[model samples]
Target: MSQIPLLDLKAQFETMREEIYEAIRQVVESQYFVLGPVVRKFEESLEQYVGASHAVGCASGTDALILALAALDIGPGDEVVTTPFSFFSTASCAYKVGARPRFVDIDPGSFNMDPEKLAEAIGPRTRAILPVHLFGQCAAMQPILQTAAAHDIPVVEDAAQALGSTYEAPDGGGSGHAGTLGRLGCYSFFPSKNLGGFGDGGAVVTDDEQLAERLRSLRVHGGVQMYHHEDVGWNSRLDALQAAVLAVKLPRLDLWGQGRAENAKRYDALFAESGLVEAGAVRLPRRTGTGRHIFNQYTLRAKDRDRLRAHLNEAGVGHSVYYPVALHQQECFQELGYGEGSFPEAERACAEVLSLPVYPELTPAMLEQVVETIGRFY
Candidate 1:
């Protein structure tokens, strides 16, 4: 038996190697490295794919968040309410723009911000409601949007891991793609993402034409023209090469997402049959809303998580913890005054969550091997 890696980018690349080579060659021949026709074409394609009126490409996912915040004029003395269990960039982006991040605990089932606790966290300084679509599952956006509307604050979605995922409104309204559901939706083209490019890339999508125009300017040092400056912004323009690669992959993103979902189903059934759930030894990821879960990483809560991780490592199985520490507990956030036990749910998640291989290219035999390894460990 060979090692079952957590993700297999090589397998994905082999399927479209020539297509990718051709795209890269086109960029090299044109010699247009910065934002130009190639980047614009990709951006337009992304806008149509994500169902957003506008999509602005940037340098990285973290920069996407910062640009969005800057476009909203959220600066010092303002606060952005967000979940504490997500990637560092989700909270750190607020700090980058000189705004404070107000932490909210996550729903243990979905690993997303609990909308029930959102109201209590919003203060007069609250400028934006930033919710992360963690592990490709949409946050409870209906309530989050309603709360934001009540306060006249904008909702910026961190859809870094959920490019094609959708969320159906609970009120029987309709479904919208993850990034397009909020006022400004941020996406990542990091190599590991579902719609990943060859290198770092990101974009911000919005229906607000004004914000979209501002985002375009913000990515190029706050100047739409060659030298005229309007506002202070970062140099965060997305590379033409990355955009070209991403454009090649965008059309197949939903198909890849489907494959990931199928893999997740297999894991769910295998874990259930192994009696781990019944014995309370492990808890599988849960699907909450009527939307699709792309399963960026199939994470589960396990008893004695560290030992289980070690066992998998010894067995030559790949596994990882999305986050090992809650944001509030990080040393850099000490002045925020969040002590231990402040967010019990997020802290518990940080301690027990472990992600397994759920990439699209995994074979059923490989999935079985992963489950067998876990079953033996238990």
Candidate 2:
């Protein structure tokens, strides 16, 4: 069998080649490169798709977080509470804005911030509550939101990996997309994301008109009008080309997510039949929430993860470790005074979690090969 890739953007591009080319042609003919009509139209479409009142396009997902924090005026001496299991930008964005990132441990099942631990992380200096929808599932937003609202603090969602994913309140209050559930939601269109664009691109979504306007100004160097600065901000505008490409792919996002979900189910069935779980060789990803899991990645908690990774490498099975280090344990964050046992669950996850190939383009044969390789490893 041919080698499987963790993600195959080339295969995805081939399926929509002409449509993508036409989108790019329109941008090229217009010669409008930066934020323009193309970007505005994409933002409008995204707002409707994500159920947000407004969406502001930005240069990257990291910028989306930084802009959201800056707009909220979360500067030095303020604290931003977030999960330590997420990508670096979740906490780094807070640091970039001159605020300290106070971490809350994750729920081992969902791999998201533990809502029960959220309130304790919030103190007098706390400015915002940032919860990440890690690996395409929404964080338990109901309790998180209730806690934030009680404190009058805003919730900024690091939804970079969870564009089409949703969350249903356990109380049956219905469901909402990952980004829209927060005061501000950030999405990444990096090539690996489910709804990725050609290059770096991201957006901030919100229901607040005032916050939306602030985000718009923040993306364009603190002014809607050229050269008119209301407040200092970054030049983080999303490119027109990337916006056009993303618009073309936006309509089919749900179908792609469905494909990924189907692949994940197959992997689950394969692993279950392999006796891996019964033998305690590995633990399958648990779907804790009642909402759609887009399966941006189908990760497992494997015993002897590093050795298994090397075996997969030798067998030519595509795999990866989502994060080998918790944010608090990173070299740069040493000054934060987080010790080895600060977040035991996150630290344990960093050691055991291994992501397998679950991209939309994978074939059944590829999936079987991945599982077979793991079975052989044990």
Candidate 3:
């Protein structure tokens, strides 16, 4: 059997060798590393792609979320509702600003924040609803928006895992993409994401001009001028080198995302017929009702996920558990007073969910091997 490792980024780099080299060389030729013309151009192009009036480049995804919440003045004694099933950074960002992260169980199928649960979690101290578009699909947005609007709280989208994901509005006219539906949308360009860069990079996108302006100022350490600081803000800025790499990669995101979606479809079909579905040993990834599923990780819920993971790895198929520990169960958030049974679904998912190799570059033969290996285990 071939030693098929997960996420062969070197394969992608090899395919785009000349273009990447040229982009890097161009950035090197121009000595402006911090917030240079390339960075500005990337920001403008990203804003245009998302239909946002502004895009403020930041240092990382966590910082992007923190800055967005901080810009909204949600701090100390305030609460932000979010799910516990995402990357630790989602809740960590809220905590960074001294705001408590209120947990809500995720929708089992979508793996996103359940709107009904979100509505139940809101209270007088709830400042915003930080809905994460987890694992490449957008969360249920219209209902979340309605709930937030009723309480006059903003929606800060954690779009780190979803750049191409879209939604259909109720009226049928404003059917648009993710990262633009909320008051402020935060995106990550970490090397593993669909829209990735050479290194850590992130952005805050917004249609509101004032919010956009505040984000811009915040990215630059709260300074509109050289010697003046309008407010306290972190030193978060997207460097030019990562921007240049992302500028080269952005055009290919849609194509790569489509490839991932196709691979996911193949996995769904293979798994269904493999007797796993009938035997109730495993379940498949969710294809969102309105938009696409990019198969960021091709996660499946399996019985004894850790043991199953060991079986697959022994068969030379690489895999991962996106998050084996839920936030409330982690030691960091014990102060929130959430004990063992606080969020059962999230805890269950943590122990049962397993991520298989699902990059766009994966061939059908490789996918077949993955499914076949899992079948052998079951």
Candidate 4:
């Protein structure tokens, strides 16, 4: 159906169609589609799920990052150290609030930021470390956190791709959720994420009550009451409609997460059976014991990356390159003084990594087609 999409939201929607309609119907009938009970309920559920003291809803994930940092007075004259391998929003959000993004290279093995280089990158101006849990895998957080602690800098987690994923659970190497390991965890409800909603929305979860209160105040013009400004905050509150939609989807997240885990295992087994490992033809994803890899995208690194993508497409097997360019090399950020080979690992990943269809709704037959297509390419 639909050419075996990289991800088929329609299949997911069908499973929850009736419940989604009812959730929205209730919100619509009440005519309270703005920040209301539904949003707060979802926030409360999310906070409990992650073992955080507070969760504050916002308009979108990018704003979630912006608000988390903004509330902490992270702006001009500050540097937020992060990885160059992730989505631009990880760095762009820092820039939005006037902070400079100091990028470090990634661990070629884990596809996560290297902790060794992180300590070296911190300078006197470093205010925070924004580590992204790329592709549902958490960064090596303990070391990153320790480094920040030594310098008394806060950490904001870009757990945008990692909602139900944990770093220490069965999937990850450790015991804490990826985002919870930081001072503040920012999540996105972008349409393509594991716990996606119908539209854009996000939230910030923190163990600090003061930070939580500040986030709530910040999302709505800094007003404790309407028209009464205190802190000059932006208007970024979450809508009740999106909240209801997310709530309806949240209950099924764990089950879907399990599907992804199983899918990853299946891929591993298939690749092993096909002798690709012995041939050194495919660099499969690394699943270090620290976090649950949610398999947001079943990415593989190989020599003939573009050729493989074309062959998969010819076989009607969907695939994509998450980011063909590293954030530091992007045209807009050229003034950051980065050029070719500036962050070689990240640059190499951009050229080599290819994302394949790994959504929960994908069938075993579809997976076979995907593996077969890749085998033919090899």
Q: Estimate each model's TM-score.
A: 0.99, 0.99, 0.98, 0.96
Q: Pairs clashing in candidate 1?
A: none
Using TM-score, rank the candidates from best to worst.
1, 2, 3, 4
Tens digits of per-residue lDDT for model 4, 1-378: 236778889989999899999999999998998888999899988887888889899989999999999989898988899999988899999899998899999999878899889988999999989999888888888788878899999999999999888876443345777679899999999999988978899999999988888898999998769898888899898999999999998889889988988888888888888877668888899987775778777888876888888777777777889779999998888888989988999999999998888898888877777776778778
Error of 3 at 46 (Å): 0.6
Cα lDDT of model 2 by residue, 1-378, tens digit: 568888888999999999999999999999999999999999999999999999999999999999999989999999999999989999999889899999999999999999999989999999999999999999999999999999999999999999999999999987899999989999999989989988899999999999889999988889889899998888999999999999999999999999999999999999999999899999999997568999998988999999999988888788899899999999989999999999999999999999998988888888998898899999
Poorest lDDT segment (10 consecutive residues) of candidate 2: 1-10
TM-score: model 2 vs. ground truth? 0.99
1 versus 3: better TM-score goes to: 1
Would you list the rank order by lDDT, best first?
1, 2, 4, 3
Question: Which residue runs of candidate 4 sit more than 4 Å off their true CA positions?
Answer: 169-174
**Global lDDT scores for all candidate models:** 0.94, 0.93, 0.87, 0.87
- Predicted model with the maximum lDDT: 1
TM-score of 3: 0.98
Q: Against the true structure, what is every candidate's RMSD?
A: 0.7, 0.8, 1.2, 2.0
Q: Once model 2 is optimally superposed onto the true structure by TM-score, how far is the C-alpha of residue 275 displaced, in angstroms?
A: 0.9
Model 1 residue 285 CA deviation (Å) reads 0.2
Off by over 4 Å in 2: none
> What C-alpha lDDT does candidate 4 achieve relative to the native structure?
0.87
